[model samples]
Target: MRVLVVEDELPLAKLIRQGLIADGLLCDVAIKGEDALWMADATPYDVVCLDVNLPGIDGFETCRRLRASGVATPILMLTARDAVEDRISGLDTGADDYLVKPFDFGELLARLRALTRRPAAAGGTEIVVGDLVLDPVTHRVTRGGTAIELSVKEVQILEVFMRRRGEVLSRLQILEGAWDNGYENRSNVVDVYIRLLREKIDRPFGVTTLKTVRGAGYRLDEA
Candidate 1:
């Protein structure tokens, strides 16, 4: 997924960007709040890693303006401020989640996964269609009483399909939401991965939940 990292500190910003890229995310960096505002307004990012204590407009005002402009992309705020009021202000200004630094890369990755995998705030952690069950936290797949193993990318793609259940997802949408942005490979990778996923998660179990829509995209549904 495409992520915007808004941090003024050069070293820290690079670290966050590198970590996210390794996790298969497309990322952009902004060192100032104004830059953040324009970047956010210009691109359709899935998540924003916003720094709360920015030098210019600050995260609070930046977040407020983004929301005011009707941009609802998820925001994960990074802050050194530990006060309850600070977190409250972040949330009140439209940040979806907050992490207090210095934070673990694993935690940040997990939070990003949580934000983008979701179709809505009220969506459940487990996605089910037919006998297939996927646990987002554990990255485990199960059908009936048996476990199915998938590569991380496979799991991510399947999650997007399972969450929507029956909707056809275009290739570009799958790549945008399930894979890292700015990946250099060029091929029918999505179809290849989906076929591979079905070999493990569907065929062996005598289930066929993931289906391709002729001339359209792919869909996953109990029906």
Candidate 2:
């Protein structure tokens, strides 16, 4: 597998490169965030090892930019800071995984393997269907440039619809997608949430993107 190693620390960067190379993995090292961005855009590496502290933009901003640019490569953030907030920030900014500095090489390799095994992140954190957009990271939703507020259940329902935009989804399928195992599918909860989503995401925009597929369930059409 090929990887990009973005770290300003020369020794650590070289060591990582060497370690990966020994494992029969190809790696390209970048000492600056800008360089990393350019390299990542230019090359379709399987994974990226990004350091939080960098020369120009730092890893957080770099990660944010990478997602904004629609680069879906799995990003594994490396950092010396182990604070809870730092980890949260790294994830919020779009890093797929985080490894605290002074980590074991074995763990790093395992994490990389895990990330590569999973599907690459879907076109960054924002999911868009027609003019409707949902930012999974920010929990923000907008349609035709108008901001729409959604409840937890409503957001979950909308996400399900957006992910399967043109496909018809049964209530059971939607329930499984939106709720956990504890949610007893007894009432018309799915219908209620769909109504709420329509009120916010469709009515104001004068569109019926979300529709009831007769004899099936529901479908969200691309506008």
Specify the highest-lDDT model's number: 2
Q: In candidate 2, which residue pairs get closer than 3 Å at backbone N, Cα or C atoms, i.e. clash?
A: none
Task: Report the C-alpha lDDT of model 2 over 115-207, residue by residue, as the tens digit.
Answer: 976773654667899999987445689988888987656776787788789999999988766654335887688888888888888889889
* lDDT tens readout by residue for model 1, 52-107: 98997999999999999998899999999989999999999999999999999999
Compute the lDDT for candidate 2. Answer: 0.86
Q: Relative to the unseen true structure, what is the C-alpha lDDT of residue 138 in candidate 2, on a scale of 0 to 100? A: 52
Q: Give the TM-score of candidate 2.
A: 0.54
Error of 2 at 38 (Å): 0.8
> lDDT, candidate 2, residue 41?
92
Off by over 4 Å in 2: 120-223
For each candidate in turn, the TM-score is 0.73, 0.54
C-alpha positional error of residue 11 in candidate 1 after TM-score superposition, expressed in Å? 3.5
